[model samples]
Target: MPETGYMAAAVAVCTAITWALRALPFAVLSRLRQSPLAAYLDTAMPAGIMVILAAYTLRGADWGAASSAGPTALALAVTVGVHLWLRNAVVSILAGTAACIALTALAP
Candidate 1:
């Protein structure tokens, strides 16, 4: 059986370790905020992520069939157009998603 003091000390050590782990990322990120690489990533990551998402979304489409591919193509177009017109990622994504749902529902 552990003593009460030993148990208290163990709990304190665990709490400190947990706090440090949670805080480490913010500490490192605060330091990295001034780095050129972080700046570049801040600018580049959105476009890169959008491209990757677009590719992933369309990769499984059956290009030879209009019925299968039409909704996806229209959704992508709407997404791009909305993003370009509104310059808002959230609105673009929502509009594209709504377009896709409507198109799919209307499809036979």
Candidate 2:
């Protein structure tokens, strides 16, 4: 385990890098508003975000294991049902989490 001070410094460094990666483009583009690069970035950002989200979501997926199927399917069903019924973020999230926990606990 990392020492407390080392962990804090590592977290601070990671946070700084993340912030700089996100902010640098905007800062540069603001100064070059009329550039083609700016227009390209604006149009490409949504697609980039979608690809990143898809990659993140599928990163840990293990299709070879049947163990993940039941709980994941149940949680997905719960999430869809809750969103359809409540249309509220907090309620949907809580309901989904609760349903997942209950289903996981009951699973063989």
Candidate 3:
């Protein structure tokens, strides 16, 4: 077994490192909050993220196969319609997922 003094020193070093790692983000983000880039990202990130998500979700879709693609396309339409009508992302996503599940299950 290691000596008590050595173990205590090791633990102290580890604790300090862990605390620094945890605090670093707050320190960085606090500075970033005043940056123009951060302001731009705050305004632009949501739409950009949504676009990326949509592209990723549809990227692998079998567009040539109507039977496989129809449900996904319909679900996307439902998602957009629900979001437009309700103006709620959570509700729209849930409704779209449910529609996809039901449509795929019913697809022959």
Give the alpha-carbon lDDT of every model.
Answer: 0.86, 0.77, 0.88
Q: Which stretches of candidate 3 lie over 4 Å from their true place?
A: 1-24, 57-67
- Residue 12 of model 2, lDDT score: 99
Q: Please tell me which predicted candidate would have the highest lDDT against the true structure.
A: 3
Q: Which candidate number would show the highest TM-score if scored against the true structure?
A: 2
Give me the runs in candidate 2 sitting further than 4 Å from their true place.
31-67
Count of backbone collisions in candidate 2? 0
Candidate 2 residue-wise lDDT, 1-108, digit = tens: 889999999999999999999988886668787889878887989989976884565455565433355776777678779889889978887887788677767888
Pairs of residues clashing in candidate 3: none
lDDT of 2: 0.77
Model 1 misses residue 78 by how many Å?
Answer: 0.8
Q: For candidate 1, lDDT tens digit of each residue in 1-108?
A: 999999999999999999999998896698888999999999989999978986875774555334457787898899999999999999999999899888988988
lDDT of 3 by residue, 1-108 (tens): 999999999999999999999998896698889899999999989999988988776775555434367888899999999999999999999999899888988999
